[model samples]
Structure formats: C-alpha cells, structure tokens
Target chain A: MMPMKLEDLLRTKPVFVNVGVRSFGDSLREAGYQVIHVDWSPPAGGDQKMAELLDDLL
Target chain B: MTLKEKINAANEEALRRIVAANPVLVDVAPASEVVPGMRDKLILHSGPPVTWERMCGAQRGAAIGMCLFEGWAKDAASAERMLAQGEIAFEPNHHHATVGPMAGTITKNMWVWVVQNKAFGNRAQCRQVESFQQFGDYSKEALSGLQKWRDIWAPTLRAAVRKMDGVMLKPLIARALQMGDEMHNRVVASSSIFANAIAPILVDCGRSKEDVVATLYYIGNHPFLFLGLAMAAGKAAMDPARGIEASTVVTAMARNGTEFGIQVSGLDGEWFTAPSPRVKGLFLPGWKDADAGADMGDSAITETVGWGGAVIGGAPGILTFTGGTAEEALGFSREMRNISVGRSPDYLIPALNFEGAAVGIDIRKVMQTNTVPVIDTAIAHKEPGHSIIGGGIVRPPLECFKKALTRFGEKYKE
Candidate 1:
C-alpha cells in the first residue's frame, strides 16, 4: 500500500499533535494543514493516549 | 598504555597521513582564482568540524561545485568519480593549518587566506566566504548567487585585499572578542572592526561604489566574516606549538565527504579519523528528513583549533541553531575551559567576565570523560542535492578520540 501523503493525512485528520516545539505545528497549519500540539514528556505517553479518548471524533 | 599516549599516537598518525599526502598550498590568488591544488584553501562552515563521512548536503554540493569551478570535473558525478579514483587528492584544511567556511572547498587558482607563522615557517590557508550563502542553502537562488560572488564579488574582494597591505584580521577579532561579540553567531563587533579597517583602504583604492558597497555589505552581513581571520589566527597559535613530543593538543580537525579527521600537537601533521556523525538540529521548513545530505567540509577546524562552537556562550545567538539555550552556551564554554591547556589572552570573552576564550583541547580530558567535543553546526539532511536547511549541535565520535589516544601511547612508548 502506498503511504499517505501529508496532505492526505491532514485532510482526513483535521487536527495533529506535535510533541516537541509548537513552532513546527504552527508552520504546518499555516500551510493549510490543521494540527493540534501536545506538550508532554516521555513518561506521559500513556496519559497522552488516554487524553486523546476521542471515540466520537474518530 | 595511558590514554594520553594512545591519543598522541593517533594524532601523530593523522598528522603523518596529511603531511605525506603532500597537500601543498596553491596560488597566492583570491577565491575567484580557485582552480585546484592552490597553496591556500579557505574553509567555511560551523560545528566541531568534520571529515568526509560527515561531509554532506550543501557542503558536499558545494564541494562538487568547487570541482566544477576548478575544472577538475565536468560536474559533481565526475568529481565523485575522481575522488573515488584517488586520482585527485582529498586533504582537509586542518592538515594544511587552515579552515573553510560551510561546504568549504579550496581548488587550485583561487586566492587563499595565507597566514604564515612568521615564528615557525608554518602556514595556514582558507577560502573566501560566499557573498550571501548563509544557511548554506542550495536553492536556484543560492547557486546563481554564488556564481555572482565568484565572478563579480570575488574579483572586487581580491582588488580590495590587494589594496590593503594584507589585512591581518586576528587583532581585530581578538579585540571584538573582548567587546560583547562572540566570534561565532554574534560578530557585530568583529564585523564593524573589520569594516572600519578595510573601509578606509577600499575608499582610497578608487573602486566603483557598487563594487565597494557590495564588498562592504558582504563583510558586514556575515557574523562569521572573521572565519578566515580566525582560521589564520588559530593556525598561527597552533603551528608554533606543533611537534611537542608529550603534548596531546589537537592541531587541526577537518572533514571531506567520507571521513572526520584530527591532528594533534604531538602528531605534527597526521590525520587520525573515524566515521563522522550526523548533525542534530532543526531542518528546513519544507524539506523532509530524506532530502538532507550527510555532514561535509573542513569548516569545523575552526572549533577544533578553538572558536566557532567551542566558545558558544561567548555567542548566545548560536543557541537558536545549535540546539541550546544561552545557559547551555555558557556551560559549554565552562566545560571547554576544563580541558584546554591555556586560555587565549588575545581572544577574551566578555560574557565570561573577560575570561579568555578556551584555547587548547587536551586529549586526556576527551579520553577520561568520553565526552567527545561538542560543536554547534548547521544540519544538512542525509539526502543529496539540497543545501543547508537548518542547524544545531553535534559531537565528534569518541572513537576518533580514543583511536587518537591509543595511537599516541604506542608512538611515544618510552
């Protein structure tokens, strides 16, 4: 299967999560890609997944 | 064997290889005259310095461009072929007691920054900086821009250099170091001083305003406008100290596209090397991870000889690209202080409360700490073709240091 292009990935997923600096995400959205930034440490990976409990959104 | 001994051997071997390669300085001409096998080669770049494996991206591209410029090859493909064929030589600037800016390339015919150690018969060379090749970007704009620099900017600079009684930029740089300007990212003070020194000569030379303006603008714009000067100064300092039997001080560090190399005081002019490490830093806005090239060039010799990234705290602005805060920069300076043989009374740092910049990196410290030297450098993605997209920090592999240390021990086994 072909990998999804960033544009395709973004069109389906209106929001995105960037773990590091928000600067990359901000620039991405400016290029018409919607992204949501999440600032979390390595230990918080589990909590982050739980926080993204968007069964309805999915 | 003691780690120091091993390091000395490595340094010796590295030096022997470089000297045996018989890399002679080419023409007394300027950068525009860069043909090939010139007596002087200028290196331009940032970081801990690199060898060939580390040479990548814009630097590699530029190396190819340099081959084209020198007529060594019809294009990059032929250049690579020549490099592989071993028909053409691959010598680092450090081997010649020189430094290069980003994607540093010194072909024959190009005028080089010629700084002979009047005290020791030793000499160093470096290439001129591009007029506007900041970010090491290899866009259409960047290539054309460099061409303009070669044709128009370089000749004018040559004329200006000729007019001036051979500008010795070290004193100016040393003074600037004392005055709030770090020799790396924050060279406002250095640039101003250089401009002041050269401006008078330029004005009196009776050149056209556009040429003069262009030259002045180029000099004033790059914070590292003093890179050539610093390489020359470092060469002066280290050349005098070379061939000290028990001394494990590094004399030079440089990279081509295939290896990272180092030369030590004890080793004289040998080049000990290991695979170069990939640089860690911010990438360009649009480029993907695959679009970058590996590390390339001889510019890092500046840091290996001291200055560039070694004294980062002296230049806080470097934090943005080198992947650190101002505090980290300061810490880097302090850390380097622990390893050096002495502080440079000449290159004083204002931020460290008038402390002298770290002068020499001791081989013992590298072996004990396993902390290979860290350098702030621009990042080129692993892919080829694209120019420099972003920059950050990187550390030379400890293996190189270990190898140097190990070799030093055997060579001087008493």
Candidate 2:
C-alpha cells in the first residue's frame, strides 16, 4: 500500500534499487536496485539521504 | 632517533619534565564561556576521587590558591568559610566541554586551547595538563610551584605559542594514530610528531633561539600536551553530530558536581545521568584503595571518539601505570573498531601496521551489540574535600543509549 505504483508497474526483468519502508511488503521483493529500507523506527535526525548522496557526490 | 623512537622513549619522561618546564599562564576564563555546561559557584576537580582527608597535600593547597586566584574568598580561611557557608560553587571539570587532570580548576584568566574542526563546524576546549594541583599535594612548596608556573613558566610558553602562529595538532594526531600512538595514556608518537611539526614553526616564527629552544625542549619533554589538543579535536568532531534527530552519536559525557551525565545525538541535548562510577585500577606507589576518588571530568570523550584508552595498545608503556595488560590493550583497540564507523587515516596504530584508529561512534552498532562505550579516566573523591587520587576504567551507562534508540525510533517511524 506504500505507493507501490513504482513497484507494481516496474519491469520484473531489471533489478531496481528499492529505497522503501520496511513496513511495505514489496520491500521483501527483488528489484533492480538493492533494497534499503528503514525499520519501524523513525528516520534519524540529520540528512537521512546524506549517505546515499555522499556516495553520489564523492 | 627516528621520530617514533624519540616520541615513545620521551613520552613519560616528558610528562615528568612538563612539571618543571615552567608552563606560563597563557590565558584564563570562566568555565561557562571556555567550556560547556559550567555554572557559577561550583568548583571542578580532575581524575577520580580522593576524599578531602586523603587528597594529596599539594592538590589541597592548589585549591586554596585557586580560591585566592578566583577571589571567591580572600584566603584559605575565607574560602573555607564560603564553602562551609555553601556559597561557593563546586563542580567537576567534565560537565563543561573541558578536561582537567587533577584538582582541575577553571578560573576567569586561564589560557585554554580553542580547537575548531572545520570538517564538522564544531569546537572543543581544554585546559593545560602541564601542572598538577589535583594531587592534593599543594603546600608552601606547591603554592610556590604554582606561583612560579603562573608568573615565570606560563609566559615563556605563551610567547612560544605566539611565535608559532598557534598549533595545528590535527595532522600530527592523525599521523600518531596511524603510527601506534593512542592519544590517551600513550602519546609517544603524537608528542614526537607535535615536536617535529612545531619545531619548523618555531624556527620560522622568528623567536629568539633560547626561547625557541626552551619551547622545543618543553614540548620534547612533556608528551601529554597533545592530550589537550586531541581532546579539543575530538570535541570539534563530535559536537556537530549533536542534536541530530534519531542519531545516536554521543555529544558530551561529563560529571557534574554530583552526577555523570551523557547527552545523546538523537535526544537533542537532553542529559541522561547516573551516579558517578568509581575508577578501578592500580594507584601510585603507597596509594591505597581508601585513598582513591570517584570518576570525574569530560576528557573521556577522547575514548568515546576513539583515542584515549580505546587505543591503549598503541601506548603499551601506560599499561604499567593504568593496570592494564598489553593483550587487553590490543583487545580494546580492536573491539572499539567494531562499534565505530571508520578509521582515522591520520591517526594510525603502529603495532597494527599503521592501521587507523577507530573513528565515529555508530549508534545502530551500539544498540545491537549492547557494548556501552568504555573509557579510561582519572578518579576524584565524591565529597568536595579531596581533589584526585588515581586513574582507572569506567563504562557509560547503557540507559543513555537505550533512551536514544527509543526516541530515534519514534522520530523516524512512518
């Protein structure tokens, strides 16, 4: 139910990185992108996306 | 000698020599402005506890001098009168973002190191470790020693600092970490590196040869000066991560006059505290357990940030005094890596083949492992009477982490 619009229509052939909530069922499914999901815990303070971005930036 | 050999060999001897090197009073300020979490009317001490009765005579006498220095009271009698009147401020050095070695006193005019970490946009501060008043050994001898330090010693050194354009210790510390010098009880590599770095600066600063030589000898002799620099650097690195929602990074670990409090990253500046724990370790010769004090001060953050005792094997010499085995020291270094996020490429442990010391405290790893951080610290007595007796080990209360995780969960949950 977590806006699976991207998950449902996505092609099954290519693996996609799934940056989704752990609460979402599709989180368990395979995709092109490696799945990185946050647990029931809330997002931590600071830039949550900073790590992924640093990867992109650096 | 190779820089490494020179540093390691001179490390302790340097600490011994710093006592006589004559540290001039560079500057002084109130604890609140110079250090964080300080309030008026409270006095701060260093290391672990020593009761008023058992405190080294020298430290007690220094406290009397501090009282006079602060003008809190006219003399020891007036100071005692004010303290007995409950009008004096007594606190631990840890509560503020500063560290003191023994009977650590922060007055309005003491020169402190101000370290700014450009990478993190934070600052950390510390007082000089050159002198020893916390020993409770203050007497006519001790008071004269303090006077000489303030008038004669502190100035020659302050001039040196002026000549050198201030010290940039981060690079040397980074190199030491890689070279097997943990910045805590063992500072051989760091001290040597510091001397090497400063020597060039001293030469270029255009100071008199004698002054430069005096400063050089002083630095060459006392290995612990870098401890303040390392603490300041660690403070700068860690302060930025404070107040991040759901981040479990610890900001400050300090002992107030009465309790040990830790501020976690996710909690955003809330202090979770517990009664101060006692330091466990060997004491100086002739020192007995009854004479030891409870844990005190904010310097342990160096370990929390991964230096101090966390990398003890890098300083095997300290093991003799701190009551640790080399194997255990090595184990501590490796175990710390497990909970940390990265290694400081600058600070390398030589025995580990120039492996970087652990850096960054990861909250997730701490939550999963339940390994509360360990810190090697000095102990002071609980009551206001004594200054510092000896040094030992302590653990940050686990509740601080538990509470941080609980809050981080709530803040980030969908």
Candidate 3:
C-alpha cells in the first residue's frame, strides 16, 4: 500500500488517535478537534515477555 | 492579553519546563547523608505537612517503626511516647527534596535513591522498598526485613552505583514504557530493566560473592524495586516546574490515608487538600473494600511527569492488577489529557501509536472539567500494622482541585 502523505493526513480532519484517558478525547472534542479513540488492550493478556515474543513473531 | 490568557501563557511555559526535565539516577545513599535538612532526629512522611497528632493509623505506625529502627526507643510503647512528646521532629518528605511510597516514612538511617534532574540540577531522594515498614507494619518480621535491607541490600547497591558512577534512569524508563510499564502499578518491565542495567556493576564492585549474590537475588525478585527510583525521578522532574508564578500546573499530588493534597506551580509550597478518597477496584483474596485504606503515597509524582497512571492505555497488563478492562485503561489514559497542559516528549506510550503520554497537569483544566486526577495505587489496610492488602484505582478528591483553583485565583487574579 502507498504510504499516506503528511499533508494529506493534515488536510483531512485531524483524527487524534487517543489510546488512554477518555477525557483527553472529550477535551479534544470540546475544543472542536476530531479524535479517534482506540480501545487499547494488553497484548497476550498483559504479559510483557509474551508480548515481546509475539511482536517478534508477527 | 486578558488575565486568563496571561495565566494560560505562564502555565504553558511552566509545563514546557516540566516536560523538558531530564531526570537521571546519580547515586544511592542514606537519607541523612543526601537529603537536605534530613537531620538525625527528623522524620519525613508523605503527603502535605501533617503533625503526628493528625497522622492516620498507617503513618503513625510507620513513624513508631522508624523510631524503633533508629534505636531511639527500646520498644513500640517507648516509640509512641517519644512521638507524642515531640522527641522526633516530623516534616513532609517534600520539604527535604524527597518522596516516599505508601505510609511514606523516611528516617535518617534508611537508604535512599538519589535522582537528579540534569536540566535543572535539582535532586530528590526516595527510600528503598521494604515490604512491611513502609506500609505501616511494625511486626518482628517487618523489622527484620528492614534490617536486612540496611545491612545487606543497601550497601551492596551503593557500592555498585558508585562503581558505575551513576545510572541514567530516563532511557530505561523510556524503554520500559514501551515494554508495558506505566512505572506505577505495573513496574515489572522497569524493574527487570533496572536489574539488568546494574547487574554488571554489582559484579564489578569487588564485593564478597555471597553479598553480591544475595543483593542480586533480592533485586531480581523484588518487582517493586524500581518504584522508589521512579518516584525520585518523578520528583526531580517536577521540582523544576514548581514556583512558576501564575502557572496553574500541578507540581505535586500526594495522599496520606486521611487527606489527599496537591500543590500548584503558582502556589509553590502551599498545598490544597481534602479528605483522602477511597480506592475503587479489586482487593486481595482475604480482604474486602471496607478494609482498604484511603489513597496514600508520593507515587503520584509519576503522573506529574507523565508516566504511571497517565499512560495506562499503553500498559494493558495493568488492567489485570487494577481490576479494569482494556477499554477502561484506554479511557483512563485519554481522560488525563483533559487536565494536562501537554504531552511528554520522552515518555511515549507505544500502544497509543507512540503518542507522548499526557504531562503537566493543569489545575485550571482539572477544575474546568471537574475531573480529579486518577491514580493507580496499592491499597493498604485502614489500621496500622498490616501490609498492602490489594491494588486499585483512585482519584484525588475534587475538593482538593477546587481549593487549588480558589487559591490560584486569590494569588494571581488580584
């Protein structure tokens, strides 16, 4: 896939991919900024060594 | 510019200074040896200044234990008498450029992690982790554990630190955030990383093999060993941001069992406090929520510099410990941004697509949003003499932020 250009990304409504703290997104919206909330979960059920191993595998 | 605008500009400048801070671990030494004004008779406790008369159960227990540890009293009864008679001077750890976890008691003889904000050339110290005493346990087991740390662990670690000249903590912290540590409730990654960094130094310090082995084993097994170092680092990073006039940024957030307190940059040493909020989440197998102590510790220093509970979304593993779902973690992380002025440049949350963790909590934003800062903390027992009962999430009382806002207006508006 072709990489998205920075200018193109900017030209579109800036979607802030907020990963933690939901209030951040609320604040952004209150400020009229577009925010995309990503539901982040621990990879491999929160095991760091397992996550690292999977990262290597994937 | 309008008065509001001027305040905003000053706050922005203060937050910039905070995010720009570079904290490095310089050495390990006894509290009296490194912490300024940490005299032989002075005892530093966490949260805002509270007298021995007002200290809650765990704090009182910890103080008595410290007196016993220092050989100032022959027994707990004697220690209690000394504390009541004002034989030991009590002060907040903040007054001495130090921070402590949980019951947060620091005596002169205890070893401390010395962290320096290289950018500001300011230093902060924190006591080494002890399972019992810091949590208000003064049992024979607890006292022996403290003795082991003093006699064996601290000296070995100090020698290793000296051999290495100093360990740069920021890089390790940065990496640990990526590996799944928020540097607060979930510090497994940072602890392992720190142990690895210092292992070679320990080997090269020319200590007896047995002592080195025991110290290495202790550090390797103790999951929360790096928590104190992180707290000291956080204190160092936040210290430079304090005392900025008209700046509404929060410089500190700490809780004793009875009260939660916060200091705003503009207000300097003044603390706005309220009743300590109860933690809402999981408890240990035998414990119930009713037994939990109110939020306690100076560990919120991590959130001040934009790690720990601030980056919960990046550390999904924390959910297992804090009894929250992945989505809740994400929400918690996003929520902090509402009250913060900016994101950290160094401490990025990998799960958030490498976005910087929210940094520089602004009291104005907290008040405006009616949002109290969220903290992930371990719950202690309400009464003294019990170790940690469980881990959970907590928020500083809204009254604290409201009072801070009131104080800010009073200080800067006129």
Candidate 4:
C-alpha cells in the first residue's frame, strides 16, 4: 500500500462506496455527498467452514 | 457552571466511566445463584418493564417456555394461565443487573455468564446462548437443548471456567474489533477467541473426553456465542454512567418486540418508549418481512458502550450477513460519530485507521442531526416456536429520542 497525503485526500469532494444500509447512502446523498452502492454479500455465501478456513489462513 | 457546561462535563465523566470499565468473565452459575433478586417463579425480560397483557408474541412464548422449563406448568396452556393469573412475576433484566438476547426471557434455573466490571465493582449477568428457545422456539428440540445445557453443557463449561479463574473478556474484545467483529450481529472473532481461551481449561479440568469435545464443538459451531458475554460486559460498562445528573448520554437501549425503549444517564431507570419498528433487510428462504418479528433484545448494550452497529465500519464480514458493502460499514461508523458525544478510548476500529469507535449517544445531537442510533440485529419469527428468520439493521424509534429530549428540557431547562 502506498501512503497518500492527508491534505490531498481532503481536497477532493468526498465520494462514498456504500456497502450496506441504503438509507445511510440516501442520507449522505440528501446531504449532497456522492455515494456509490456496493451490493455486498458474504464470500462463499456465508459458508461456515470456508469462513473458518479463511480466518485461520488470513 | 451553566447547565450546558454541567451537562457536557457530566457526559464526559459518563463516557470516561464507560471507556474505563474493565469487564472480566468471572463465572458461570445459575441465575438464582448469581443474579441478585432472581428467585423461583420470577422471570426477567428485555426492554422496559411490560406486563403479561402487553408482552409480544415471542416474549410471551419465551415466558411460557420458562414456565415449562421451571416445572411450574406442565404444558403451554397451563403456563399461559399461570402467567395470566400472576403466578409468575416479571421484571426487566436491566433492573436485575442482567441482559439477554431476543425474547431475553430468563428464569431462575438457567445458567448465566457472570461478568464483573473491575473499575466500578459492579457485576452483570446474561443467560448462555442456545439455538432454539431463546429465539421463541418452544419445540421439543428447543426444550431438549435447554435441558442439555442444564444437565451437561453448563456443568462442563462451569468447571472449566472455574479452573481458569475466570476469563478476561476486555482484551479479547479489543482484539476482536481489529479482526472484523463488531460484537453484535457478527461476533465470529470474539467467539473464536473465547473458544481458544477456554479450550485448554476444558481439557485440563479432568472432564470426560466426550463432554470436552461436545462443549468445544458447541462453542466453535455457534459464531454468536460471545454475544451474551459481550452484553454483560456492555451492561457493566454502562451501569456506572447511570444517574450522572444532567448527562444526556443514553445508558441503555432495548426492545421487547412490542416496544423499544431507552434510558438516559441523567434520568437513570426512566425509560422513553415507542412502538417497536419493523426490520428492513434480508430474510431466509420461505420467510419474508411480514413473518419477521419486531426488533428485540438487550444486546444493544454493545452499542450503548460503543462497538456493535456504532462501529460497523471495522467489521466488513458482517456486511455479508447483514447485506452491506465495506464502504457503507465505514460510512455507518463515521455517521454515528456525528450523533455521539465522544470516541471510545479502548474499542478502536481498525478499518478507520484505528480510530476509536463512536461512543456515548447524545440525545441533543441525535435530535439536532435528525439521526438515531443504528443497531444490527437478528430478526426472530413473529410467532413463538420458530427459530430466527433473518438479520437486519434497525434504528431506535425517533419518537423515543424526541421524548428523551422533551424530558431533558423539562428537567434541566431554566
């Protein structure tokens, strides 16, 4: 990961990639903030074994 | 000092006590043995105090199940009759230094996790998690699971917990926040950590191999097992904030399916209530929004002290279960900061560059911003004798916050 300057990050209009709760994004958009929704679901459709394996490896 | 200054100072002190409180998992014992005021035929429930007449379906089911579990009634009809006849005394879990999950019905014989807040010398308790009855399932299987806990699981885990001299929960929670656990809807990390902590103790307790394996397997399989302990810890953390005059920080937020309620630090035990709102989110196959019960549980205690939905940004894995993207999770955390009074000094969200989780929900800020506290919760079936139907996010009814604000004005405004 490359380090980004805090000042540079702040200079741009804030755009949000909304992952959950559409109302949250709606609230932000109503407040004039830009938002992009990500239709998020669990990796492997929430398989317990896979999740545990990933936890162990990661 | 002006009232405003005093309120601010008191809120800061309340937040300090909340962040400073260290909750340790001290023991596992029957509710009657550990929870003060717990007695035979007495039942503790979630949210504000509600009578049998007003108890929601799932709550009523759990209460009837408790009656059967306690042997006070032989069947559902008899149990309902006993409850209606006032043979069973009901009280809110908050009044008894305890908290429970959905339905949150606890009777005297149930085994409860005992957590102690070392800083304030206050203790809180919660019933152990089980798949069936607690969610209002009154089937034979659910009753059997409870019986199994009473006969086998409880004693095995109790002996193990005793041998380990009690498990310290705060350190595990601190680590879990970094590992994608918000300690509410998703507690995978905390659950795993707890299992890891007690695995060796169970092994060394001289229990039968079958019992040890069964106990460990049970703990490992249930990812939300830590939620009960987390609720107890949250209760301990927030209990000290109660009765701090003029503080507007919310100390408790709970739902009983019928109504949602909150208690402010300044007002102590007084609850401001509104009709419990319907949940909006994903549901299981064959189940839809209409089948879902209203939001329920005392698990929102996690949000009361920080973490849970207030820090969702740190727990992206929860997005999969609750339906959200990582960015929205992060956004949720930042948005909560707008309505909260301070950041937790201990519970930090790694996804937000290790920023402290927002803490101390302030009624003034909530009303001013037109934003209420959000909670990620599991939805139960609308009727009893059914398992959880889905999971979703919900907000405290705006009316509850507005009512609190009105009360604050009446009490503090000159």
User: Judged by TM-score, which candidate is best?
Assistant: 4
Flag regions of model 1 displaced more than 4 Å: A1-58, B1-28, B31-60, B71-89, B118-121, B131-143, B288-291
> What's the CA error at residue A14 for candidate 2, in Å?
49
Pick the winner on lDDT between candidates 3 and 4: 4
Error of 1 at B183 (Å): 2.5
The alpha-carbon lDDT assigned to residue B405 of candidate 4 equals: 73
Candidate 3 versus the native: TM-score?
Answer: 0.87
> Which lDDT tens digits does candidate 2 get at residues B10-121?
3223222211121121223334465665555555654323344443334445566567655676667776666555575554454454566545565544445656554434
lDDT of 1 by residue, B387-412 (tens): 55666676776666666766665676
Report, for candidate 1, the interface RMSD: 22.8
Overall lDDT per candidate, in order of appearance: 0.58, 0.56, 0.84, 0.86
Error of 4 at B283 (Å): 0.9
Worst 10 residues of 1 chain B by lDDT: B18-27
- What does the interface RMSD come to for each candidate? 22.8, 13.1, 19.8, 19.9
Task: Tell me the deviation in Å of residue B45 in model 2.
Answer: 6.5
Write the residue-wise lDDT of candidate 4 on B1-414 in tens digits. Answer: 877788889999988898899999888888989999998889999999899998888888888889989899999999999999999999999999999998898888998889999988999998877657878887777888888777777788899988988888888999999898999988999999999889989988877898888888888888888998999999988999999998989999999999999999998879999999888778878889888889899989998888788889888888767777788778888889988889977788888989999989988777655567879988888887787788888888988987787777778767
Sorting all predicted structures by TM-score, with the top scorer first, yields: 4, 3, 1, 2
How many backbone clashes does every candidate have? 75, 79, 11, 5
**Which regions in candidate 2 have their CA more than 4 angstroms from the true location?**
A1-58, B1-65, B84-86, B89-97, B120-122, B135-140, B143-149, B199-218, B256-258, B381-388, B406-414
Ranking by DockQ: 4, 3, 2, 1
